[model samples]
Target: MRFILVNGMALRPRILCMLCCEPIGAHYLKEFSTGLSFCGHDCYALYCGRWISRAEQVKCPAVAETSC
Candidate 1:
């Protein structure tokens, strides 16, 4: 949750991208699992890829070895 400012005054509420922190307007992408919104598909894909990498890193060594 964020806000738009005008002349140093808060004017309206806004939704910012979870990854880039850019304000999103009427149209945006949302990740249901995390309730995170993205400015565009590119940002969304980047976030998803980031999560995938994190998941990979947290795998147990024995489980990872067995999966291969």
Candidate 2:
């Protein structure tokens, strides 16, 4: 979390996705928290789909059969 100073102004840097390694947008920023941020809605959903509670996993269908 570093900022650059130019012309007496500060600027924030772009954040990368935890999965895809791409720039994150404002819509995805809503998911940013606890030092964990995703790139998009689908990225966040897929993340949740993986770490779902075992008891509730049955409710959420598998996003992928195998991890790639």
Candidate 3:
């Protein structure tokens, strides 16, 4: 199992995919942790609301802004 160091603390190894729940590939952000495992780089960007050069469907929508 792979481990990630966050603020000097070791985070438990966990799968990044939303289906099988296994860490199959590299993570986008080192500190941010999520259970959603993307199938590919395209899927990763789509999952994170990143715009690609080509036309592709956006999976996860951006969060709504809120005033605190």
Candidate 4:
């Protein structure tokens, strides 16, 4: 949830999906630990897939010189 300050009043803005940038409904998928919201399973899966790829790349970076 995000807040907007207007006239000394704080208003909560609509929650949007991090993946699709769409407004989330009552039934939405979210990661409890990271608070990552997704509109549906497809978006969540895509997010996870991307994250895994990034993690793998970071864990095993390319080596300029490989000795056998």
Which pairs clash in model 3? 15-22, 15-23, 16-36, 16-37, 17-37, 18-37
- lDDT, candidate 1, 1-68, per-residue tens: 12222232321477788889988766676665566667767787777677656667887565344220
Query: Residue 13 lDDT in model 4?
Result: 67
The local distance difference test score of each candidate is 0.61, 0.50, 0.37, 0.59
> What's the TM-score of each model vs. the native?
0.63, 0.46, 0.27, 0.64
Which predicted model would earn the best TM-score? 4
- Backbone N/Cα/C clashes per model: 0, 0, 6, 0
Using lDDT as the measure, the top candidate is: 1
Model 2 spans with C-alpha error above 4 angstroms: 1-11, 53-68
Residue-level lDDT tens digits of model 3 in 1-68: 12232243333464364433445444432313444444344445444443332223433333222111
**How much does each candidate deviate from the true structure in C-alpha RMSD?**
9.7, 10.5, 9.3, 11.4
Residue ranges of candidate 4 with Cα displaced over 4 Å: 1-12, 60-68
* lDDT, candidate 2, 6-49, per-residue tens: 24222247677776787765545333234566655676666655
Error of 3 at 23 (Å): 14
Ranking by lDDT: 1, 4, 2, 3
Over the stretch 1-46, how does candidate 4's per-residue lDDT look in tens digits?
2221123222246678789988876556766557776766777777
> Who is ahead in TM-score, 1 or 3?
1
C-alpha RMSD (angstroms) for model 2: 10.5
